[model samples]
Target: MIAEQPKTNTAASKAMAKPLKRGRACMTCRILKIKCDGVRPICGPCRKNPKEEECEFSDGPTRSRTKVLEETVSRLEARLQELEHPDETTPSVTLHDPYSPYHDSRQLSKHPSTLLMPDSRLFTPLSPFSPTSATSSLPSGRQWTSFGLEAKSDSVTSSGSSSSPHGHHASSPFLGEEEPSFGIIQNLVDNFLPHASEFGFFLNTNRFRHATLLPLPFGHHSRPSRSLLSAVYLWGAHLSQSELLLAQEHTLMIRALQHTATDIMGPHPDAVLHTLQAEVLLAYYLFQTGRFLEAKTHAATAVSLALAAGFHKIRTSNLHPQPMIGLSSETPISLHPPHDNIEEGERINGFWTVLMLHKYLTIALEPPTSVCGTLEAPGTQIDTPWPLDITNYSEGLLHPDVRGSNTIRNFLVNIPEQGYQGQSVLAMNAKAAILFHRSAQLSGQWTPNLQPREFQSFAAVFQSLNRLIETLRHSLTPLAQLDVKNPYTRTIVLTHALTDAATIKLHSIFSYSDSSSKQHCLTSARNMLAFAGFNIQDVGYLNPIIGTLWMTACHVFIDEISRLRSMHTAWPPNTEGSEDELMERLRSGMAVLNTLSDESSLGKYQLTKIQEAFSAI
Candidate 1:
């Protein structure tokens, strides 16, 4: 056996037995002064006896821990400075202030007043149905004239001599501009009153009319403020087809802005209530005109004002502070309880109006930055009941006893409470708005890497919202059962549209991956189309936000069309009929958008986008 075995190479045996030197040591090995195999990510020594600390390597020379900490602190300090002094380091655009008298040619050039003066292209002369066409072609003799001024004078005169009893025409900047004649004011009132509620005007119409149309001393304390009147005139001019009224839109808008701002700061008896109404009207006007940022600003301002005025806690009982906190709650200095049930109703409606606008903008804008600062406040609580008809308030029908803490938060969590009227049309709209906002938040926060428990929580909330939406839709008055002549008919139809839109939004995130979600989106899209079909003639009068809902439905139809087209391509023409129905539904959606586009810039924008998407396919 010894003779058969080949002599081993002594050099190779020594080479194999010698340990190779590692180029670097992992942090763990280096800290322990142990030999390392230098494996990347996880070194062999660390892997063999793994601990909670992860293995890491430094290509350069190792630094002291204190030095590393110092560098990190310096970086954080620099970042904090950047954040604290952003205006100094970053160039920013200042929003145009309509209230400022310093607006000059240079200022106008820097920031054009798109909110008041729309794009000329959007109001082309060639388009017969263009929003500006009626105003643009006014007869030479017909003109909007200022109080105590000649029709030929375009400039606003600051004359102290005026017939108004309050001297409002002389002292108030709101009335300093051109004032419509009595006949023109009446005409505008006629034009705006029918659609007032549609735009969140909660004042009693007859009271508003009587107060505003009176000779001089607008006697009642509840009379509309100069600012509120100006806002009403602005909306009236905006909605009017009269050449004279339309010509005054810009002047009325300027006056409204100035008046509303002044009224908020002034000591008017009903400043809070009137200013809230003015702000809401201005916000809706801006939104319809496609000035979304301005709309959001005004809406947020309304919400702030509402909160400050305690509008959210209307009819709420002052609760005693819990003993655990060891502090007594201060008795809120309540404003004299609303003068009457009508006034109380206005407060309730006002809170919901602003809340709806806030929620809608939260979903519609979906700003990249956090909205916690603007859209909400700490301990922001709402206990206001749902709104009822102004007539209901007049008849002494008020919301029953409140049974819940946070009306909205409780609804979101599906917490059952007694005596809450959740079935009213206005209440349903508010609920839909909440669902719309929550759906956006949920879909935005979703990620594939979410933990199982986190995902379960998300899914639970999503399902709960879905159930709520379904419940809301089922609880609504059937379209067939609604009185066509009743003004509330439009509201019912719109609420139905809103619920379907909410469903689409909630399911949109899972549309591609989940079959059930895709079906839900399609069904909702179809339902919205049906709603529009029934209300085609009145589509122009629906809330401008409905344009956004139309666009939402259009998205679902577009996706389905694209999917069907792809299937047809992949399967050799057999899927041709599959997309026909979807294309028709898409066209119906576009038709409603087109009807709205005549007056609303938002609608025009949505129509343009849908057209582009369809063309791409």
Candidate 2:
């Protein structure tokens, strides 16, 4: 019937009906060019990779491995081109510390300090901010050595086979009989370098790197200071927060302080910059670890040392001089044009750092009853210029092109026409702290029996601070393109919080009712709390000043919430929505404080205060 049913065609039909098998490998395996057993939630290969959270999958048409490789190669070539032909004006690599509050997205970076030792899988031969000879001012255009390597011993044994041409013993008195091998010292120094900026110890990154790599001759007076090195280890240990490291922190800190105290009281204290740097580091460590009194005392000591070392004065000479004294203090003796820039930059930064810490301690500590009040030496002035970025000064750019290059007092006396230099985050944060201090002082001067003259003076100071705050806020890089993970974001958040805190402190005493000032205070407090909530974890307990900001915001929120409940308790139900919203915001603030309470006692204390205050209602 019909010619054998057209030969059945069963085989052809079966071939046409068969479907193509989908890929069995997990997405991570596909991307990494490795075998994977397809699994849900997490694949076998991804489980092996520590960054399992980064593994992703899709059930769609995927590009071939060859194509992916080609695209990657293309990107590499383009990046190489850019690096090779970098513009002179634009920095080849904008060096940034991941943990520092000055993180900028535009800049490339190295592995920022973390609580854990750096992951070997993530290690690279050069830092993310690796400089090219043509693009950078580095003397030799050397690539940054990877810092994640384990601290290896380079000590020679009786066999004498351990001798390497590159290895040299940079022994310190603190090391005693067991001199730290080159690798050990390097590891410790690397640990501390990233954190220095965060603590207001502005070191010249390039110079520091160069010096660390190139050993100083034996018996050289300018050998890296043992005190500074010990302090670095202490900070690094504290920051790492490992149980072993935590145990070592006390020993390291005590040793660091011991060495520093000896240096300060020793014959050549004023001639050594490390003494100032070490004292500041000790102060930062103390402050970070909840020793407010000790921090204030050490900071005061550093400030006094800085003044004696001539850090507060800018060194200018008719003829540019050479810095023959290697790694010397920035004194009149070492005042030279070319080599002075880096040292001078450190000086300015160090001075401001001390001042900033002093302000923070002044605010955080209880006055009159506490020893903090005794720490402040009357009439101490910031004569140092606002510091330029270390990179700029490192390249011998003595004066930044920006207009606002004056002493702190002069700049504050007349808020520079240039709203903010924006050239250095260190400078900007310091400025914010200075305004905060002034605002606190103005707030403190208020008394019921104040004379008219005092009232006018305080009012003027308040107005000036307010104006400066507005200008400074305007000048900050817009947050539209901010990376939430960036440290700069924290800096911006802290700046806004401090400015708002100042405003609240200024107006709250004079106007406690539902006036514009009270409303402004409430709004600022809400903003600060919102910011704290968003970035609570990233803002960590390492920063004592951040805790102060959190405490102030919590106090304001609790007070406002209490006021709202009291006011609404007597009023009709019509305003319930507004009160509910206020309650919601207060709840958010309390939640943040609770989250942070685990990190620091200040957080716990503030959280308890808020809870008690709320319970009273």
Candidate 3:
């Protein structure tokens, strides 16, 4: 033993004697001027001395101080330059494929031209004093363009006419208090009508087109109200690819808002009905542009108008006539009968559309309070039949034999009703909307420590809603069976996507504790992604509400990724591939959202939120 000890390992002793170097010192150790072994949670010296102050490592600067100073100086220079040469500082707009794989996610997230940019100038409302007030100061011969819209230097007058400074008649008029020129109006109509249904346009398209496109001398009853017409024009400008029309967007918006206010207050044959339509459109427009509070206010107004107009109690031979409740005794009801089946069908569709919008707003905005307490409540009961397509109304294919009261409630409770079965796309969407709202509300009400009775009640409703969602999903027209060329194909695809989204929402609350629930959510999320893929190719514009659905699905993937990462310090070779697959799916979802962001401010907001969430992991 003595002989062995004589041969000491000098290298090992030397290595042990040298102290390990640390990146930074803890605050307490630095203050105490003691040798500190840097460690997370608690350092070695602090651990040895039980009474020592808690160890806290300062979060030092992420970038070098010199680098930060340089960035600050550069930003100041840019600001000074912009102020000195404001006219020359106008940013150039560029167009690119949002879904292209070559584009860097981090770069896109920080792009100055993105809708999420912090510059107030990007979203400034054009002053109502002049149609071109916002664009008037642009340098001559320099044009501002976006979204495939070419720019022009045509000057617009405050009056209802438009002309270039060179005295040339402009192609489009500056929309003012007066009605727009026939060609301008027609162009707006063409841009809006094709995608009308994508929003909540429940009126008959043929009737709307006839009323709007026809010149004056048509009967007042046959023509659209100023409110409705203005709203349509607003949407047209909002959706147009023409820079001329796009320039008038704010003008149209202001005109629409003013007309809607005036028409709702004035006494006209179609005041209540047309204003109702306008309010819905305005609400949707406001929502797409990130005016959530205004959107919610307009939505509530639409609901009130629908109720006042007696749209909730549309009369038919088979349905019992019910007096509207929740109205003050002084409130007057519209007792006049609809002129024809088309008018009557509009009322029916109108109610469903109002209900769907209300529910969607509730889900998307998650307002602190709802207009009507719940879909199943007595005051909110829907007696109107499920909506039939405009074509069905024209063909006299109405569901005259179907009864109405508690229509939505019966469906929710799993009670079979003749009218609720084998429904059309519009009807199915209405049904899905109810289920979607119910599931979201129920999930919010969930608690781990529910009393026995409460638990039982909650379980029963959950099971019923789950079964109904599955049934509705199966009843949907399959994507493969749809005619791709038909415009209605988009509607069908939307319904399917909505159903799948509902399933994920329904199971989301239980996903953490129940494996089956987790799998169900995962399956639904994957299906929604597939639908998104189809939508990207076939559908030109998506309703902004779909952004909520996409966000919900993204949450499912995010939760899954977090769970797998927590399971092991390093992923097993076998499971690593699956984790990468989930990440890919998440990226695909984000790409779809990015594409939507190009057209919608809400989509941009959602995409930014999801990017932040993914980056946190």
Candidate 4:
């Protein structure tokens, strides 16, 4: 009577010990077996708690589901055939090999003969002093080549390429691209697109940028040469990491193929080896997700390959910020040396393409701000440069001379010294990568006396990214918004333009670090939202991009709000605490954006997207 006995359930206990059925799905989706819907992490069920770790799914029904569905569909078709034609029938399709892109028409991505040369073209310096496109003789636009493309034909007839359309960057980046077929470029992009939605979105976002998975510019069928060349071709597009990763990945493979092709055929040695650096980044990302061994493998591979091929010279700020070396980085890298010193790095142009690569490697292996200060100041005779932001390039970053900060405003100037226009742009991209990732590390600093080193680098990177945008914009023919006439809608081209615009909206980054202090940064953010809000009143589809900016802006705004709250909490006796007004000022200023009457369709779309994203934030 005092206690009742509970019944034991052996059935459930036994089930716990039994192996759960493994599922079929893509490597990424299968890893998180929860319910792939074929897309995995991005799929509906998996997305419920993006912050939570997704379940590994490769083992059970998930793995075989695609085949099962295909089989069922085939049987239904056969039954229908029996009811109609009766005699004719075929079994369901079967995957041939164990690779992602099965049955893709283009197979030989890289051959020893064609890709022999290390990636010398990827990080050479570009001309840095060119005037902005708004003021230049030309109208700058997107260039896939800078994205690192290497198509079979330097001159594919526009008519021949009509099967796939492409958008021309506003700038005439190519030597003689009068008017490439828009359809062909679209086809190329569509076919070479790499699927990398795993990391967060947007390569340039103020969030954890290092975690972002960059998109490829091509569809699945494209070969390596196409991707390498497309890097430059896509250069003017201003794509984010996800937007550019595929092309970048393709570049590595293509360079590899080119080198391999050379060994088999002869030694063209295409001289493109920066792909090793790209792999290191991907490995770092994987490492972040808890794949340490894989990361080590890639880092080691990149280091060895880089050294073996003399590709170590390709080091730039973004791809491998710190190669694990310290101040005396001159030690020869025999095999993809992980920590080459920056001091030993060679310099070129107003830019430091290969030089920055050393920094990139160092950063990846080590932590931030510990580069032994490899970044060099210009010679005494050379004047110092000013700081810059995305939309206001000429205003802050450069001296009237523009050489002090090593900001390469134009692509041509660095060509002779670096030997590859493509390599230099990538180096710049690497620097931007560092700055972008480091910026987010800035937790809200309330009374900021001296800005944190991370913030300083962020500001510095923003300046560089702005300079790049200015250079690309200046190359366009007449400064028109991108107008790609392709079926895939050629999102990369539009996204590239949008990414740049997004960068411009990030004026919020410099808030706490400035001389005016956190107060000034808060004021600046509130002011930006007001106009940015109006920009949305102009469009809808653009709402997605706007959302990215809005969320980032909110992070800063919210930080300031919290700062005010802290001030109220810690106000000294003489220090008056009528902080409600400060709060009202910011909240009310933020309100102005929503009230903007002239919001464009793109603006509204971006705003809405951002709002949904922050539904949690």
**lDDT by candidate, in order shown:** 0.68, 0.57, 0.70, 0.33
> Residue 444's C-alpha lDDT in candidate 2?
72
Best by lDDT: 3
lDDT of 2 by residue, 348-397 (tens): 67766767777777777754223232223464433445666677675655
Those runs of model 3 whose alpha carbons end farther than 4 Å from true positions after fitting are 1-176, 217-221, 316-335, 367-376, 399-401, 419-422, 532-535, 569-577
Candidate 1 Cα errors over 4 Å, as ranges = 1-178, 217-222, 318-334, 367-378, 399-404, 417-420, 569-577
Better by lDDT, candidate 3 or 2: 3
Worst 10 residues of 2 by lDDT: 123-132
Which wins on lDDT, candidate 3 or candidate 4? Answer: 3
Error in Å for residue 366 of model 3: 0.7
Task: Show pairs that collide, candidate 3.
Answer: none
C-alpha positional error of residue 36 in candidate 2 after TM-score superposition, expressed in Å: 99
RMSD of 4: 23.5
376-458: candidate 3 lDDT, tens digit per residue: 46665567777888678877777556656666666776676673333877888888877778778788788789999999999
Total backbone collisions for each predicted model: 0, 0, 0, 190
